[model samples]
Target: MKGVIRTILLIALICIFSIQFTMSMVIFTDLDNHWGKEHVNWAANTMELIDGFNDGTFRPDDIMTRIDFILALNTLLVKKNIYQDVGLHFGKGINISYTDVDRYHWAYGELAILATYISEYGNADIEIKEIFTEDTFNPNKPINRHEVLLLSRAVTTPPIEDHIISFKDVDANIPNYNLIIESVNNGILRGYSDGTLRLDKNITRAEAATVLRRVATDVNYLADKFLVYEDIKSRNIGIELPIFQQIDEHESQSQLHQRFIDAITSIQYSAFVGHIPYHERHLYDMQPIETLWGLKNQNYYNVIGNNYYLIKYDKDLVMERKKELVKEGLQHLKLNVNSSFDGLISFLSIAAELLPMEETMNAAEATFRQSDNSKTKLETGLFIMSQYMANNEMDKGLNIHRSLLEYEFADDIKAQIIRNYGYLLYSLKGADEAIRILKDLKDEMDLDFNELNPNAIEFTFNGLMKQILIQSKN
Candidate 1:
């Protein structure tokens, strides 16, 4: 009897352990159609980057937001021990703030730090503020397909150039075409069974997990790209150097306006002017209906530069379509610049840069004067200035610069505005006047020459100053 009782107790113990193990394990019920079931499960179980709902469902089709994506990226960063050596406050010291992302946001710290850290790695010294609306992160916005490719491409070195995209929807001319192709080659991105890359589609949770997995394990991933930031963190490695420093305490409003213009110009120039082989051939193939659709939907113009691409193919056709949209948009702006801010901004930017329509520039300038918000004023003024520059109206552009100089602005903005003024002077008056203006302005701003380098925005201003000074001597 004693032997039988002991055996029963052992059996019960084994059963109890089994129950606990089964309860702890995650099992998804709705992965029948998931293209990346194995990958999602591995990431979910191993990395814990992806999670399931209360009902034990992965909800793979659900959209992933910018905040969530940033969180996952932070997880990867943590796993790689990227921040372990860096100080506890690596990103906290940066004067980076996002209007839409408050302290209450769950991923605020991660998003803030990653934004700063990624900016350090890019070919373009992209400040976090340049990507958003007046220092807003728009954190809750869904991460779209193209953004995934673009972000990955920005950070990782592609294996090789692959112009071929298996998806039927992706044309070779779009801005993200090569990025998508490279991502596919690296096994980081995929297309649907319907043979669509769905470049504008909002990314799903499953897709995000798969991509993150690829970013971590793919042979194409480059760890050396992060050496600069790593070296910065290691104070004992060599002569310690400050990567960036703030300008003077006080800045004029005119200067801030110029900074805004430079930011906008950089964005448009990068988008429309960058070279991608085989893009021109695909540009001619873009259908009129597609252009119309893109204009109506505002379909991630950064991804394809579709409006510009269409214009390049047939300028009159693109402009005619834009006129209709611009008319409606201008009417909305006339209603209230504050109310139709997005539409007005988008319209003005497109019109100023790609189309350079006289009517649009006038409306943008008028809207700037009517607006009370400094952000709006800065944005609209930038659009107007960009339009003038595009139209070769340098004198008119100088007038805009001169008018903004009277307004008080933040220090950073003021520095940029003065830089613009100096450049304009160089363009219209000659190198001597421009050099004098820049020298006086530099002294007034108290710029730290030691902290400035070719990678700095101040470097651009200073470089222009040096070029003018040299030209004057010659």
Candidate 2:
């Protein structure tokens, strides 16, 4: 009787396996698209569920809003039975807050507690009223491209090694930049042909789905199953079908589905993988001075300056080569500086018209230091002040402008300085002071309308005027 009972139990187990295998095959027929096609062959053996909108539109371009991410996450959790069979409902409410999020917002209460991805400064409670800043969570704004990469890294199990996705653009100083880079190294994501990760751009849904599928396969939560999608051609299915088949048969349905969702949501919470090969290439072979002469790639120059310091003495013999390259680069820069001085002066003269206030200030400072003649210094100083009104460092710029006013210079240069100073005061949210200064300059000089190079004067004046007008209206 004991042997018969054991035999009966073994038969029941076989029947259950047969049933599960059949269910997996049926599910394979439903998956379609690049992501589905890749995993379809193995999906029958794997019990993973690939989740996204049913319409076959991955929406790779749309931003993942907070609500959308929460819904996707909850769907994964529900499938996984993470909350248990007792059916503890993931409550939804509009009025949840812990002094950060707005009570009336859609994801105000539920997502914070349920996802638990973010926590208050010192506790587990959600900070509801907290406005999302660059370093903090901002629910409403479109997530940047780099954030998606970081999120993917976080959910990934047994985190990847350091320095995999090396990018020229990502500063090492950025928080958790290294972790995100490692995820790319581990084959979790990829970067574009361009050397930049474009961290500021928003991520789309299709991109997220593709990432999810890759992570799911890596984690052993998916089965290797062969599948064919109606929309995806046989040639395009490639290796993905077999991978899907493997995961489908071996894993539970809930596990497969959760992995898919996790992949999709990873985009908004991670750093972007940059062009690794190119970055390494530039690092090893310092570009020739001629290469940077009239060079368009300022980013490349910045990388060289920041990484291979020409100023420092090092035990590495490569340091000598770097210093020689820097000397050559400086020679080329000097030529450009001299040849472009007049153009630069013209540009600086009407900086308010052509450049941002910050840039204008930069040009002004550069000119003042580089100019050999006192006349040029006075002119550059006036231009600097004119453009400096919009700067956060306006007080510092003003002080320098006042000092220039004491110097004896050519009448033409001095007049330009006075006119520019008046314009600067006007632009710096000091309309009353600006009017008084402008009146004095207008009274003192024979204003040459043509000498006011339109290219130099128009752009800055118009831009400042527009800013002033907008501010006044607000």
lDDT of 2 by residue, 73-167 (tens): 44444454533333344453233433444655555545544434332111112232332333434566565456555554443332322344556
For each candidate, give its TM-score against the true structure.
0.39, 0.31
lDDT measured at residue 75 in model 2 versus the true structure, 0 to 100: 47
Report, for every candidate in turn, its global Cα lDDT versus the true structure.
0.57, 0.42
Query: Best candidate, lDDT-wise?
Result: 1
TM-score of 2: 0.31
lDDT of 1 by residue, 149-263 (tens): 7666444444322446567887777654655677676556767789887877889888888788766653112322211101011121111111111122323433433333343
